[model samples]
Target: MSIKLGIIGGGVMGEAILSRLIAQQVYRPDQVLVSDPQAQRREVLSQRYGVNVTSDNGVAAKADEVLLLAIKPQVFKAVASDLVSKDGNHSSASETLPMVISILAGVSLTELEAAFEHQPVIRAMPNTPATVGAGITAIAPGKTVTANHIEQAKTLLGAVGEVVEVSESLMDAVTGLSGSGPAYVAVMIEALADGGVAAGLPRAIASKLALSTVWGTAQLLQDKQIHPAQLKDQVTSPGGTTIAGIAELERSGFRSALIEAVQAAYRRSQQLGK
Candidate 1:
């Protein structure tokens, strides 16, 4: 039997994608190959998922079907060297090498294509919420990538949540909004909980309220196809408590602060790519 999916990197995000794929039965455990540097991680993945696990990046990189690069950007150079090395003896040796789909932040398609040389490469930005199948991922495909390749990437990525295709030019913006957006939302949740405590609610209940409110509101917006402004207007009866809070939020520059945070994150992502 052939390994249909090869995963490089066995960290949190890697495991999140792996577990979801397996849970959805998109690929059987036997068809997956996971590579990690640590023996303990390799052992755990093998035992838990019954997938083939190895320390050789080359083995995973040369997988027969799709290859996922879940490694950190910092280690990509070392890993790429190993994958592309002449001594590896796998370079150009087969025509069935997998298309590369990368979730490595700050790694560009140009760099991925330069390393793989011949395979279709896709750069993906996925948020932390993907761990629970509530997140969204934006993918940018390389020049060699076709409609079929995009669909393939989407099928795999969709197991975790939603997958959207965007232009490479908009990836940085996607990074700013969705990639780092979770942290911003987490902060908002925290602050909302704190505000509830300040208003005399118990800490635990306040936390739950904050989390549920955000989650439900997002679901409602999507379900109703309503704009956020429409939701706000619907909730904010003239001269009511909701409008009172909205006025305070506007005065405190809440919207501008979030906007600037995204801009800053976008700039930082650009810097890292350089």
Candidate 2:
């Protein structure tokens, strides 16, 4: 099947996705259309990715087989309103309606369906790490979606990262855990660097080592298929230095703090959706 993709909003997330898809050669440049009101952003994306460009959301939505809504949550209603108006302009009800995949934070499938009049909609949460092609995305499909639509959404999203199918109810939790997870990890890396600096390493080397440690550890944990707890055990000798540090972390309520942070994010996401 010919896949024509239309993307609304060419901000950081939109540009990141387009760059990855272009680099991977998964879809021809001509098959993709990007719409952003900012002329500078449109010009940069057009020059960088060599895709069709437009300032009209309706034009982009109507030109493609699949439409991706990458705008901010605040602007979603406006965009949806425009799409509905375009649909109304068509004389026939049987006119083809593009399947929509939304990456707007806190936007729900129900609201999207309501705005688009019960069209097949998929809501996805993707993280900043997608810029580096190392992101994880979670998707929840609406009731009207078909198997083919689901697969197509997966294929498009998977171009920039690993895509996981999830229940709509868990989407906020997924956002908390993974969508905001990168910043948490980044903060930990910064702290680890500070620790190394206090331990007599130069600031530059400390930062590099701290980041490498996290990267290498994550690679080992994933590649070895070992439980993270088991990996931690492997590094901690009985009653040794690592165990002492672990004790301090537990005493300081590190795990509890992380859990609470995730819960807080989840709650905020839910509130925004409402």
**Root-mean-square deviation of each candidate, in angstroms?**
1.3, 1.9
**Runs in model 2 lying further than 4 Å from the true structure:** 1-3, 88-93
Tens digits of lDDT, candidate 1, 70-123: 999999988988877743413662465688999998888988888887788999
TM-score of 1: 0.97
- Model 2 error, position 260 (Å): 0.9
lDDT of 1 at 184: 97
Q: Write the per-residue lDDT of candidate 2 for residues 92-126, one digit (tens) a residue.
A: 44778778889998888878878765357899999
TM-score of each: 0.97, 0.95
Q: After superposition, which runs of candidate 1 have C-alpha atoms over 4 Å from their true positions? A: 86-90
Q: Output the number of the TM-score-best candidate.
A: 1
